[model samples]
Target: MRSFDSTGVMEQNISKWELDTPALCVDLDALESNLATLQQTVIRNGIASRPHAKTHKTPAIARMQLESGSVGICTAKVGEAVAMYEHGIEQILMTTINATPFKIERAMNLRRWCPGFVQATDTPGNARALSEAAQAAGLVADVVVDIDTGGHRTGITAGQPALALAQLVDQLPGLRLRGMLCYDGGAQHVRGFETRRARTLETLAPATETFDLLQRSGLNTEIFSGGGTGTYNIDHETRGLTDIQVGSYVFMDAQYLAIGGATDDDVYSDFETSLTVLTTVLNAQYEGRVTTDAGAKACTINQPWPIVKGETGMTYSSGSDEFGTLRYDDPSRTYQLGDKLEVIVSHCDPVVNLYDQMYAVRGDRVEAVWKIAARGMST
Candidate 1:
């Protein structure tokens, strides 16, 4: 009954079973295997691997990925980058655009914290702002031009417009154009292997053209970084991409599983589902319905329903902000009060952001408690 404790008062070295319910758990063995596989795959393809820290948001895991041969780590925000720096991660790429005065200043300071710090830009105004801020801070901020690549997110058109932005950054005094970044987020989840591969290739065409344009304009950048777990294999085979900035491959979720692999025959099982939510059945008085403690606040609501580990004939439904309802097809299999259940999260990113710490478990024992360093670091 004492699950979901964030008081920071729990004793150290507690067994996994002894912990309270509704806890965030990471399988240490599975995590290590995922890290090793990603690094090995990237190395086999001869491309730099920079795992995105925004997914795990734990410095311990970031360090493991780096130690496993990742070129660097990618952060989604300046605050996340700061957290990584506090944990002694020296090389970081802030993969989002920062334009506001305070955010630009914070990003500039982060550059000072990590010598290899880099940020992305898609507009000339933002580029100028970054250049001015870096100049005022007495630093030359490394920058990457962000290509839209059909995501319709915060990026410029990949070909001429992206090259134009790179040119502007080059002309700016305190901004150094490191390379171009084209992350096809939608292509990463295109379901079938051939469709995902074809979509990823088509989306990156403009990025390739932009890279070539930059070279012809006498402004060849050093790196072409952008990729996700969904398009890791596709990006690895793409010639112009220098580094694959993948995040979710480390602790895959239901969404990634549904994306399937290049063969179109199986889920992208290159990595294991190392992360999970351990919930406790709080109520089971109903005939075929049970309720657990994990809700939107715990496991995130953006993804599909969480999968009940090793169980069939049951479906998890959203109940309240702090609870989930389980509907079972097998009425005979009734759950009792205080019964614990393990669920693979629907989405790993926001689910990780909801917890302050995660228990690294091996079998039934807790191996370590890793702090979520960048939980609320949205800025």
Candidate 2:
């Protein structure tokens, strides 16, 4: 392996070190376990796992998933796809719709570089825009029609409109109709397994019907893509889905754990919590309370309050923008200042996006620092 010297040049000399607290950390063992577990699950169910790279946003993790037998990766933006392509990721599915000329040009550029680029479009106009751009670039772009599977986010109605989009792809020059892309973002954290399964079936029905309609209309619906960490297993069992695009399973969060879908035994035996926010107890004030360095700025607080790992009888509370208050009902139990603590973020994706790098840790040592390459690439 190559090493860097004190002058910051690759000299094969110096040892690397870790920074301070309030940094996002990945448990190497847990992360590898998470990747292997998801890959095995998808393979066992006979589905292609194309994990969404929007979770980690790092090419290194994407490579891990790809090496673990993931068919490809999904991104929410063209810039992310370009980054992944530059990093030698050939196959990519841009999950969002790109309608404007500027974004279409970017998509075409990516297709030029990586011929395996695929995108999802919901409207005929968007499809036309992409087709025109790709035709000008002299490259064929693979396209999937996005269907609104109860998320109400960015997909078209999953019936005639979906079929129309597929037809548009078939007729449009420089565009190939690959399949359908429908995501039920609402099912990611549904409380109970039965409830999630029921909602998933309800959400997937229209999309599946649309695929069937397209097939019947002589359009080959080759790919039916959707699913997330919370509902991968359920989506895998769905009849028409040909591929799974789960992201957060690589980095389990507090919200995913709080979700009551799978039984406790099922969760424990299945996915491992691979991500955590390492914080230090900044202050020990108020007999039963302590404050940590990580708060809203370090971790995402949108879903619910975070949980302190293995700190029984202690509940986490938001102190301020930069402090997290920990409370214990037992007056006898106390946490002192400068105590290192691991916090499970309520939401993993947004929390990971907040940091610039993730420290991959093994036991007590920091092994690697992976840059969050796609962080803040919203445009």
Candidate 3:
């Protein structure tokens, strides 16, 4: 193992153990397994995967996904799409609605660099704005109509409203309606398999009906996209979905496992838990508790405290900005100061966004480090 010098520079090539604590680490083997499983699953179902890149936000992983037979990638924001495009990912679907003038202009500018860039809209006003902006830029922007398939986050209600918006987009001068985007984000974590499946179907009904109405009206819907990690398999059961936009499958988390779609081996439906936060115990003065160097700032506190990897009796709790308290029932087991512990984050998305880079490791060896290129693209 290489040691950090007085200036905090390593003398030799760094291994996983030699790297600083509280680091974001990706198990390369598990990551490869997850990527392959998703590719195989989508291919076996005769559907295409446009994996949401908002989870990892790393272009290296996105390129790997594309190489693994993914049709495209989906991003949560226009800025994220631009970042990905700058990394050489051309086929990107900006899932979030870019309505504001600045964002719309940014999307159009992004399309200039990557012509296959597409944006989503849930309202006719936004569609018109996109059209006008794209026209002013002398570029036709490909657009998708986002249907409120139960998340109620940022989409318009599916049905006549959806059909009307599609009609409006078709009439718009510089926007081409690519298809519909229906995502039941809440249905992705329904706990039981049957309940999750039924909930997904029930919630997707409105979007399916809207698609039917649009098709009957002679509207060309080239792609019908939407699906998350929890419902990726179930999404294929539906005839209306042409592309599944699963993201978290690339890196399973405690929140995802709580949704209950894992296989018999406890894997998250064949997707392995590749991403983990490596923390070192800094304080062991307490009798029943120990402290690590990761907390709400490092790992997400939005869900539950991260699971202490491989320690069933140990429970983690939030400490201050840069610490985590761990409690254990087994008094026999003692946590020594400087001991390393890997924690499975409760939520993978925001946790990944917290770090600048992730160390890709194969066992104890650090293979490479990939930058989280779209870390703070909140636009």
Candidate 4:
């Protein structure tokens, strides 16, 4: 299926494009709208938008984000950074901790390949390892001290632990202590705006205070990065965040919609539901029940069940490994076999990792296809 450009005129030629059922499909119109909304919002608020690439896992989308005035991109792993760099993304911050020597060597190589490559670590040992690796490579590695705000994840707690780590990073010969990294994963899904704001401040305030302390200690705190699709607006409004690392806003999922961001309205429309699982009705068993080709394998079961778009009074239930059951109370409005349906995934990031390629669609036509190049680049 072929779609026309923004002109709306149908093309006479249709390519022989066939996508397997239960594959991921991205609506191009919705995707572009989502990107524009986030880019505009970040710029309007005077904050640098460095969207995380771990969501889309596509270099094409990353290039678009950079073109939209994003300062850089963030990845969760070294392999992801390498893949993005190979795809022409220059500045990247590996948000996760990299302590292994092999990983440090790889990071140093990446820095040599790409002019701007940064990594975060919370301990002095890892910082020293990175410094040694960079020294061996005859280059300086940009490092950020990861701070534990409230997530209790991989980061040093504020106050003594954080200060000590920052001081050590500064003392290291081949490491440049860039700034502090703190991400409140827990605040991303807080339902109420006030509640989310309160939680974000509660966590981020301490981290910001730690950054202030680092600056007071004569260390430059250049970049204070954190935030996601759920908390981008809140973090932008917050005082100390210089960069917002949002990723899922480009292809919103059902889980983010349930987060109840700044408004009580349907959050799905805030950013269009660009990512979807395209399924075909395979079984029409019973009176009011139908089965689709996509099951747990196609859609992520990480959050609550996915919602069927534009289909009211319909509930989706998992059916084994290769099928999903959709039940509707009204028997008269039943779907027949071979009918196509678009399913909204619960978590866009992980669900996107499940696919190999994403079909870009406009209306009912396919315009382009993007590869999930870094889908399994977890290392």
**Winner by TM-score:** 1
Model 3: per-residue Cα lDDT at residue 14: 68
lDDT of 3: 0.86
TM values, all candidates: 0.95, 0.92, 0.94, 0.92
- Candidate 4 residue runs with Cα over 4 Å from true position: 1-18, 265-269, 331-333
lDDT of 3 at 265: 27
Query: Candidate 2: where is the Cα deviation over 4 Å?
Result: 1-19, 265-269, 331-333
TM-score of 2: 0.92
Per-residue accuracy of model 1 over 1-379 as CA lDDT, tens digit each? 7778576634547777677867999998999998888877888888989989999999999999889999899999999999999989989988899979999999888888678899999898999999899999999999999889886887998777887889999999998888888788788778888888888888888888888899889895688898888878778767678889889888888888887775554677778999989889999998888999988888777667898877888888654798988998864356799888888888899889998999999987887888999999998
Error of 4 at 312 (Å): 0.8
Worst 10 residues of 4 by lDDT: 8-17
Candidate 3 per-residue lDDT over residues 216-280, each given as its tens digit: 99987888999889988888877778889999888898888776763532334557888999898
**Cα-based lDDT at residue 297, candidate 1:** 84
Residue pair clashes in candidate 2: none
**lDDT, candidate 2, 82-103, per-residue tens:** 8888888888999998878898
- How accurate locally is residue 226 in candidate 3, as Cα lDDT from 0 to 100? 91
Q: How many pairs of residues collide in each model?
A: 2, 0, 0, 0
Task: Indicate the TM-score of model 1.
Answer: 0.95
RMSD of each: 2.7, 3.9, 3.2, 5.0
Alpha carbon lDDT at 140, candidate 4: 85
Q: Write the per-residue lDDT of candidate 4 for residues 168-203, one digit (tens) a residue.
A: 988988888889888988888787778888888888
As a whole number from 0 to 100, the lDDT of residue 98 in candidate 3 is 86
